[model samples]
Target: MNPDMSAGSHNGISMVAEGGYQVAILPADGKQLTLYPSLQIDRAYYWTFEAKADNPGDKIYTSLWGDRGAKTIPLTSEWQQYSSMGTPNPNYQYFYFWSVAAKGNVYLRNIKLYDAQDLDIVVEKEWR
Candidate 1:
């Protein structure tokens, strides 16, 4: 994934997802984009991001994994802010944002994660 430094994004960089993936699986090595201060058990956390697709129908979504598995949230094609809040499983570990399919492109920026009390947590944008 190449970050588009010229996108003039809210953050220092914008993710440029060239192609889509059916599933953003966790790597065997275990390193993934983890939310700092590991979400507390039975507490709600808010997740947000800015995204835009290259084509009108192109899209993206995120899958959040916890003890059981995860849930998905769809994103729009145009540049806009998106968010979700929920009490994740006690074993919540990592989350992944993936394109719809093995086609199209999408750009994402200004990703943020916060707890129920509206406190911003450190989210390291690491890729696997």
Candidate 2:
């Protein structure tokens, strides 16, 4: 299916998806989503989002791919916050949100990406 955009809380953009599975690829290019590129090695970075599933167990997760390798965080169905950090590939750069095995629908909004050094500043742009 085609990607869609809709209103979310605080008039922020929200990503809606239905069917089997969907993902917002990263480097979050301006056209797709809004996230920074080229993470520093061994640095602590945070990625957060607000999400709810149409049904229970519609796995939501984040993927980090770098020269070091890859990492994933299993997310919940309820609207909540989650965070994780890992070594980044010096050669590769990017992260992504995945709705795996999603059978019904899902809503995601308020995405934030930042480093531990500064929680006060979000590095991502408004998703489009």
Candidate 3:
């Protein structure tokens, strides 16, 4: 978002993503997102995102990235918050979010990314 834009609103708009395991600066349902990048893999840093569905019938999901084991965290239309505590993966370039799972109106906010101390690249022995 530009300096002129305000939080919780869609203005000065950029790219919008639909769903599932892909990366986007903004989540699908259009909520302002902010980030604090840390390449410090020494320990784990975590934050929470609260999703209040536009419709109570809608079941939503939330997900944050780590070194490994990435998936969507499920939530409902009611006010719900998800917390993550794990050693951030410096190996991964960018974190991703999606909504192909629950399938409903999803609102995402307060996303925090804590990276590892440093990235270690692994080389495979067998070539496919």
Candidate 4:
């Protein structure tokens, strides 16, 4: 986590005991958390993870830097699996999750990035 951007009075990110991470957002606008992950150009990758928020209706916006656009993921109080497929731009390097308008704790687990060919295996073994 980037301390400078993540260290707000009421917002932060932390590891959870059971496995995974918790991102707490302050109850204000424009709160965000960014993650840097190495990605390759012209390769389609499958991004999958399970996530849940502290409250129903909370949401987070996610995207890969330099990708065409972002995705809005809706969260419920229950854990749910989400997935997306994209080919990163040559200079893409960051993965971001933020609540531009809402605020709450979002828990993430089983986050996986798989090459296109390995996606089916992951789905059969982990997502089933």
Candidate closest to the true structure, highest TM-score: 4
Q: Cα lDDT of all candidates, in order?
A: 0.46, 0.46, 0.39, 0.58
Pairs with steric clashes in candidate 1? none
Q: Is candidate 2 or candidate 4 better by lDDT?
A: 4
Give the TM-score comparing model 3 with the true structure, all chains together.
0.46
Q: 27-77 in candidate 3: lDDT tens per residue?
A: 345443323343354564443444555455344322334433243454556
Tens-place lDDT digits, model 4, residues 1-128:
12222322233555444633543443335555565556667666667667777777777666666543367777787878786666666675556566545566666555556666655554422222
Which runs of model 2 end up more than 4 angstroms from their true locations? 1-38, 66-78, 118-128
Residue-level error in angstroms, candidate 4, position 77: 0.4
**Per-residue lDDT over 10-84 for candidate 2, one digit per residue giving the tens place of the 0 to 100 score:** 122243353433333221121223233556766766665666666665555454554222223333556655544
lDDT (10s digit) by residue, model 1, range 46-89: 66666665555554545455422233334355667765555666
Every model's TM-score:
0.53, 0.53, 0.46, 0.67
lDDT of 2 at 40: 72
How far residue 62's Cα lies from its native spot in candidate 4, in Å, is 1.5
Better model by TM-score: candidate 1 vs candidate 3: 1
Ranking by lDDT: 4, 1, 2, 3
> Can you give the lDDT of residue 126 in candidate 1?
29
The lDDT leader among the candidates is: 4
